[model samples]
Target: MSIATISTFVTAALVLVGIALALLVGTVGVAAYQFFSQNRRVRVARREPLVGYYRTLAFG
Candidate 1:
């Protein structure tokens, strides 16, 4: 094949690989954010009960 043809093929392949990598990273980032946010919400929900119990014990 000619040099120009080879160069075009290589460039196209690199662009496709870069796009795939970017999508994978974006997906992983979104999943991680969702996992952490859900964990934080659960922790916060559980804390309210513990705080109320501590207050009752301290006052009464």
Candidate 2:
């Protein structure tokens, strides 16, 4: 009922929300990277130049 108590509750809620957002974003990013990498690999396998280019960029 007090302002101080309400402020504390709001702070805790905001922190939890922030943490949840970070986790969701991180998961989405990882999933996107994997999907793109797989697609790139598939394309590379279907072509020689792309595969070579990817390899050169990765290791050379």
Best by TM-score: 2
Name the runs in model 1 displaced over 4 angstroms.
44-60
Candidate 1 residues 1-60, lDDT tens each?
Answer: 999999999999999999999999999999988876666665576665645644664696
Cα error, residue 51 of model 1, in Å, equals 22
In order, candidate lDDTs are: 0.79, 0.84
* Model 2 lDDT tens row, 10-49: 9999999999999999999999899768778766777757
| Model 1, C-alpha of 11: deviation from truth (Å) | 0.2
lDDT of 2 at 36: 67
